[model samples]
Target: MKHLCRKVVAGIGIMAMCASMAACGGDTAADGVDDGSEMTVEVFDSLANYQGEQKGWFAKLVKDKFNITLNIVAPNVAGGGSTLFDTRSAAGNLGDIIIMGSGNGQAEDVVKAGLVADISEYIDDTEYLKQYQSAIDELTATANQESGVWGIPTSVSSLAPTESSEGVEPTFGPFVRWDYYKAIGYPEVGTLEDLLPVLKQMQDAAREAEGTDDIYALSLFKDWDGEAMQNGYQFPAFYGYAEGIGYVLSNAAGDDYQSLIDEDGQYVRALKFFNKAYQMGLVDPESTTQNYDTMYSKYKEGKVLFSFWPWLGQAAYNTTDHKEAGQGFMMLDIDDMTIASKGAQPNGTSTFIAIGANAKNKERLVKFVDWLYSPEGIQASGSQTNGAAGLQGLTWDVDEDGQPYLTDFGVKAVSGESVTVPDEYGGGDYTTGASQLNVSTVLNKDIDPNTGVAYNYQMWDSELAKRDTALDVDWQEHMGGARTTMEYLESNDKLAVIPGATYSAPDEDSKISAVRGQVKTSVVNACWQAVFTSSDAEFDQVWADAVANIESLGYDEVYQVDLANSKEMTAARQEVKEQYESQSQE
Candidate 1:
């Protein structure tokens, strides 16, 4: 690997150089290739938000820099299943660029099938990716590659592997409209069940005050579900449990494991909780059929009262106007719950980016992929997903003292406010003009070498200084001056930090994969049915029938495999925890 040419300069210099290069209107690509001829790269991105041609600012950025137009093929928007992937794989091409989950055996499967390219020969030409060589090697090894790099893992962190990934907030927990909760006098919620009555009162108050019929305490969507109902699976994590394997929930401590279908397990309990919400008219009736986008719209309208993730309701509703008005979602403590927090992933997250083996313009494609790992690429493309500040000189910029600050446009854009972008950057609202790939190459919490701070704008010194809005002040006071939700949880010992480790379950054999697929379909269908059941009897019957159906399909055999995998994961996690403890003691 010859690390000769640095395509990007350091820090804000990279942005300045790229902007100047684009302004020059030269016919040469960044890598010195002829740019007179343009190429449209087909991107099969499982995490993409838009399904067709890439547009807006991101399109312009790539076009100017690489002379490439991205044609995104998103399975998420095109039906949300393996159908697209299967069809594409059968046709002898997945796409020029492939982005998908690495944990489900898909990444390894593609490597074995020769669907993706080995980019080891080209890695030396990349500046940023060289720093992530360890991550690339780990992923390739996982794919059983002896001498070639098959993929680059997503969300690679610069932090030590022993540290927790969680920054200011845990990914999952209960977040509710602060104004309504305060209006109700902030009643004590001692348990999961106690949250129901409190939510009901809040919903009633919101409806009466706003004179709207659409208000609901809970709103859910089914688009993200896989082997089980994702919404149902979230509740268990709030109680220090997470999915270890298919149908298996493991506690954060990685000691106990339970089948999701067990009568008394957290999955069923979550279903019952939703059923109770439905009976109390606190759940949105449209929850069953709606997708995430639809549910997000409801959140933007203030129709939904509670969210299981901080990103969801906060991203959609926490605009400057709303926050200033003291009306936005904030973390509400559930005393009995120990929220699960994800630890830092030094080996990167489960998702990965790979190039097709038969991709057109192989060298150019590799160059483009390499750029995605660059600081410039991380800011430009990552702004849409991982909370990186948008393009320097546009959404954000460095001051004379070299401190990063969000511009006026960025201040509005980062907070989910609709702002018109300049025509030079692609004319449109900031949200729509954002990159549609919806995947991140680096973790937002990773420290930028240039800035000496996390890539996330929220952590920037400039952004932090402006956090004293009415909503912030009120929430801080209510939480006893806790600076952030994570601080509040940690102060009260209500958070369970899951250690980050590089362990993954071995890919299931053909027989096990078939059985697992059938089991997944049955479990998902049954879970949804139970949530919408009219009565306790109906819910019980649904669960019983699902168990019987899956068992007949060899559920027990699959469970044994999953159980073995869970045990391995538990051991791996314990090892990481022990290593961290030892380090701290030193």
Candidate 2:
């Protein structure tokens, strides 16, 4: 855990230092610096799990390249609430590096309070960051009204702003255990309601085959819930809608918005779906009390038969051994469902990365941030999450034909196998040793210049040629020879790509904010209660009571404001889409 500070010196001094270090059998740093000054940069990351000094191969990489050490401070892992963030912000400094969401008035509040440094002055000095100038500009305009570059948006894409970023898989939609689904004879799921019977059959088959009474068709958690039951909110995405300002669900095509409590809206429909599942004993009874980690553990244990996102069930269940055995989660077609997907975000994603205004060694911090956007940095830092091949020389390398291919160790590591690293590369478990920053500077599906293919290792020709696992082959065969889920969805016109745009809702006044808080609490509680109701009568009564309770709390006034904001966001998205289309035509 030695932290080093970089120093700028004359070319001759740098040469002398390198010569002296060489004479002493020491190697010069990757960036050609040989300074002895030491420093540790504190990073406040909202998405990270590991806290304290970063370790293993990722630590070694950054230490050698920038001569610095990263000390992570993760509020999510520390206390499971915002206590750490509130205290740190009140103390006048969040951290040297801050990663947070751009929603909920957070980015604006930080900018107005001067908690984050304005990076406009240092951006031009970055070598690789210049390519994302447009993304930075869009974020500045939306968050600060173009006043200054307060923060850089994460996951900026190289694709056109109008194109979806979904490659082989999507972030939303239903995934079922393929083996269980096949056991039930691949019944047609014509609508959301039809899925209940299918899932029940799959669950029964699993229980009978495995001789376990612990299996459930659905497992959910409440820790990630905010304004509403997040699990219920996910259903709307299955039918081409996403949560808008507050209490409203907007279409992915940016054309319409509706109140979440609407009698016929997707949100209510989702609540009914969950209630039916509960009535059939298909839902995990502990869902209301469990956290994400607990629910995920169930998935890993093969006790869950359904998942709402590919990332969740797939990551938990799709081990190499499971796939070879024709067992894993696979996206299932819901005839009435139109999956909501996001297009390439030229304006960047909702997450923001910024430097604290009170941080020391500001110049070095800027250099470090800039490196995160570089190709090499993207490869190394994004390896675990973004599906990028890791650490060029060790995990992957360019072949004789100049195409990137994963090394044998890389294949094993990426496939979730236990592989020991050589001591020179910071030996440890590959997955555990990954960088814990939990943020992406560029989209993984974007093309990598060196390979003429996407940064996702799955998209590489070499990897694709060998990707025919038994589970994959079975799923493809059942889907009429479709190679991937995205392909099947697109061919069937079941995907709705939301055009990317940079927009943040205006800050709510004190009265509106208060009303929103009360209404949200009431709605979220009511929805969860309705799901666990003993009968359909109780479910109906719960909804009626929730509607009356929220109305009494001035829900209508807040709804109007959110509705207006939704319209404004839709208009902004349309404008961005038109601009991209015009540029392409020209």
Candidate 3:
């Protein structure tokens, strides 16, 4: 331990010398220092909040440990983090610490521009980070060799324990109101063709039963669009396509790639289905204009009869009253396709953390980063506590058998019974900082010392036990156990294509990135217009025009690049799989 500490100090010295900005002249001590002086680091990611505002228990822990405050800068819909990143790079105002989501091009661009610190030499020196050398190597393998490792992986958790909820139904898929389905006689849904008709009948039944005129068969929001509207995620999965942020790989085509706008494409077919639904008045008109929050509000009121993601429906459905009333969202085995979340294969790493080359307090920041990857740090960062996922005494407690259990406040917060805590108590909500920790590498293997069960999955059975018969328990029993649906899907060979696990190479990103953006906008607009068209003739016209417009806007170029990249990515994934298999055998 002493030797490792010395190495950590030596590594920090090298980083300080390499830093482009002037050092703080030892305003704070180096590696082993624990002075309580406050240091603020700016962070840019989806988890960003207004500058210097601490939001959750994790943030509070970070402050207490390193005495560092994080000022997170999140992206808006008009211009995502990439746009903000560009502006900041040009102005030299990039955040002190930067985090890039998987497949994002900002990290590559900034690293190439010499804006990120190279922490390569420090990894082996740090006690905690050294354990993840393989993960770091895999993530950085495609990058510039001269630049060294410029980022640390975030959000990479090992597969849950076999006894845990590892391969249960994914959080994404077709979801429906269980009570409404049962009320309407559980119409046959063995095929995609049966789904819409069943939904239409259910919608009518719901309106009649509730005496409400505003119920919708399905609700959608426009906020989550990436390369295509959020529906892009749903439709492609049904078609057995492995989709990344901007590209799609079809299982039928083998290694071939096709964006949604291609000829005879799954996306185009999905649009036609939506068009029929819209014509049948099964879709909410506000879907095109409303945000996620609005859609969530409607979901809570049981106004949405169908949804694409389980979480959207599960949130409101998890409540005591909703469960007892049999009104929450439940999974379905709709015939047309087996819906699945984008495969969560270990991509090595998906998110990256790097400090700005121009950052101050370099030594302190390095130490803080090292501490975050430590075993103790993983628990401090990831687990849920009382009302928040935090430390034991404050947010949780250990049992006589050394099992960590949620405090009453934690149960209330996590179960969505009541998430808000008084400001006078902790001054932050329970949901804050859920993403602040990168537990991807730790969750699978790290058993909370106090909890015999893996901390991540320990709460699963307990949480289910708390739900009434109509909610989680009902859903669990309906599926014949947590893993039953997944096992069935696997046995039937009905799983969707698993996307490649690594981020795309810079060459691929440069070639297709911009065109991919243009194609997305064109596709989204075209899809909506195609859906809203009144007659079959009008639909054909609208669809053709949309396709033509997208093609003109560079759809073909993006598709070609995606095709080439897909083959390479798939091969890389195979290699990683083989390596892991070999390791297991050994």
Q: Least lDDT summed over 10 consecutive residues: which range in candidate 1?
A: 1-10
Clashing residue pair totals per candidate (backbone < 3 A): 3, 0, 15
Using all chains and alpha carbons, the TM-scores for the candidates as numbered come to: 0.83, 0.88, 0.80
Instruction: Name the best candidate (by lDDT).
Output: 2
Q: Across residues 227-279, which tens digit of lDDT does each residue of candidate 1 receive?
A: 78989988898898875677788888877888888889887899899998988
lDDT tens per residue, model 2, 204-298: 99999999889999998997777788898888999889666678899987767889888789999999999999999999999999999999999
Q: Write the per-residue lDDT of candidate 3 for residues 1-586, one digit (tens) a residue.
A: 1112122112121222222332222122332453558887887554333344556666666777778887766543223444555555554545677655434344444555555666665566677666666656655654444446677776444442111123344545677887788887766677665788889888999999999979998777787666676675566666566454255645522454666666477676677778788888998999889998998899888788887765577766446777776667777776667543333344345566677666666656767777766545655555342112445554566667655667777656555443655453345666664435323434433344445555553344454355446555555665546533455455555565453256454345554667777888887777777778887789998878877888897787877766666676666656655665676689
- Candidate 1 accuracy as TM-score: 0.83
Q: Whose TM-score is greatest here?
A: 2
- Worst 10-residue lDDT window for candidate 2 reads 1-10
Q: Which regions of candidate 1 are displaced past 4 Å?
A: 1-40, 51-53, 73-94, 103-105, 212-214, 286-294, 359-364, 416-420, 423-432, 502-504, 507-522, 525-553, 574-586
Q: All models: lDDT?
A: 0.79, 0.80, 0.60
